[model samples]
Target: MTLNPNLRLRRAARIIVLDPEGRALMFRYDVPGRPPFWVTAGGECEPGESFDAAARRELLEETGIIADPGEEIARLTPEFITVEGEPVQADERFYLVRVSEARIDTSRHTALEQRLMTQHRWFTRAELADWPEAVFPESIVTMIEQQERAR
Candidate 1:
C-alpha cells in the first residue's frame, strides 16, 4: 500500500498479553465500512501520556484486564488505509505484558463508535498462524514467530 505524504503517521502501542497457558489475547474488530480484522490489546497514544501508560490504559479499557507491561518485544510500522480509503499509518510499539488474569468486560470502553468488536479470544501461536489472510500484519506475525522461537 502506498502511503500518502500529506497524511500523518501516528504512534500506537500494542500489547502481546500472555497468560500461563501461552495464549495471547486477541479481538476481532468489525469496522462498519471496512473489512473485519483482528488485533492485539492496544490503542493510539493519548496526549501527554507515555506510551507505556497508553498501552496499559488501552488494554484495561478494551479488555478490562490488568497487566504489568514487560520489556519491549518488537517494533513495527503497520500501514493501512482507513475505512474511507484515506492513507493512514501506525508506528506500532509491541510490548510483552504479563497479566494475572483475563477479562472480557467492555464496560469502560468509549471508542466503540465506528467498530464493533464481535468476539474476543485467547489464541496460541499455532492458532494465530492458522488465521485467514490479512487478519494481522506480516510484521506482527514475524515478531510473534521470533518470540516463539526464543521461548
Candidate 2:
C-alpha cells in the first residue's frame, strides 16, 4: 500500500492472543468499500503511554480480557488507511497473551469499530495461512510457532 504523504505517525500495541489450543483470536472488519480483512487485537497508544501499558489496555478494551500482556514477540511498521478513512504510519508491536478461553466482549469498542468490525473468530495456524482475506502483521504463524517453541 502507498503511504499517504500526510499520514500521521502512530504507535500501536497489538497482541497475538492465543487459546490453549494454539488458535489465535482475530476480528474481521467489513469496511463499506473494501474487502473484509482480519486483524489481531490492538489499537494506537494514548499519548505519553508506554507500549506495554497500551497492550494491556487494548486487550481489555477490545476483548474484555483482563490479563498481563506477555513479552513483545514481534514488531512491524505498516502504513495503511484507518477504518475512519485517515492514513497512518503504524509503529506496531505484537505481544503474546495466552488465554484458556476464547470468549470476547466487543462492548467497549469505539463507535467506528462497533460498526465496521463485524465478528470475531479463532483461527488455527492452517486457517491463518490461507484464510483468503488479509491478516495484518502477516507473520503471526511464525510468531506463534516461536512462542510455542520457547515455552
Task: Give the alpha carbon lDDT tens digit for every residue of 1-151 in model 1.
Answer: 4444666676778888777777778878777767777888787798777778888888788777777666668777767775446566767778877566655677776656234767778887777778773456445556766887887
Candidate 2 lDDT tens digits, 9-80: 889999988988889999999998999999999999999999999999999999999999977888888888
Clashing pairs in 1: none
Query: By summed lDDT, which 10 consecutive residues of candidate 1 come out lowest?
Result: 133-142
Q: After superposition, how far is residue 14 of candidate 2 from its true place, in Å?
A: 0.5
Give the Cα-based TM-score of candidate 1 against the true structure: 0.80
lDDT of model 1 at position 95: 83
Which model scores highest in TM-score?
2
For candidate 2, the lDDT comes to 0.90
